[model samples]
Target: MCSCQQHSGTANSTSAPKDAISFRVEDMTCGHCAGTIKKAIEGQLPGSAVTADPASKLVSVVGAADFSAIKSIVTGAGYTPSPDRVS
Candidate 1:
């Protein structure tokens, strides 16, 4: 599942922007997986903000990102990313 959740308030130095595109990564089951996913996205998309939460299995990106690209990145990092549904 995935979602585009609207957010507000100050952008933390490391926080994804308000218009975050989120993906549900079922295979991201721990901090290490989250870090790998985050690293992969950030590495490919410089100047983008990424927040990967292992507990929630949510990977949010704030920058020039779309579902296909995000899914590709996650898949390249050996995980599965599903789009546009919450749960």
Candidate 2:
């Protein structure tokens, strides 16, 4: 299966939350990487709002989807999640 197909299997069916959750992404090195991460997360969690700052390597996600599952998506996209930033 392709990477996209593999990722589709991990997609979440839950609804997004009202408040946003912030996380520090250590592997987002450029604009393209940031965009890719944003798309990956939003695709996995429908209704989610994702904002990523490549300079600070911070990704804030607002949704009701499972955080652990989201983290897995980040890892699969080649980014490291900062444990301290997770709530």
Candidate 3:
């Protein structure tokens, strides 16, 4: 599957909270990877918003999402997510 197929675009949810935390996923190589990560996080967090960019290797999560849980989700998705910056 084309990786970009899963592109969630930017955070379009005006009502959702902004990024509470961000992750540096070194292995997130393409849109597909980002999509996978995004899907996993949203699936677990429900209302949370995720912005995963392969180019920047960053995954920002907005809403009520636990840091450890996000890490676990990224890792479970077959990627190494390091704590980047928290907002």
lDDT of each: 0.69, 0.68, 0.70
Candidate 2 per-residue lDDT, tens place, 1-87, comes to 022321212222223244767777776666666678888999988988787766666777886447788788888887787876544
Record all residue pairs in model 2 with backbone atoms less than 3 Å apart, i.e. clashing.
Answer: 16-64, 17-63, 17-64
Candidate 1: TM-score?
Answer: 0.74
| Candidates 1 and 2, the one with greater lDDT | 1
What TM-score do all the candidates reach, one by one?
0.74, 0.72, 0.73
Candidate 1 runs further than 4 Å off: 1-17, 85-87
Cα distance off (Å), candidate 2, residue 15: 22
Name the best candidate (by lDDT). Answer: 3
- What would the per-residue lDDT of candidate 3 be over residues 1-87, giving only the tens digit for each residue? 233435554432223245367767777777777778889889988998787777667777878557888888778878888865533
Number of clashing residue pairs, candidate 2? 3
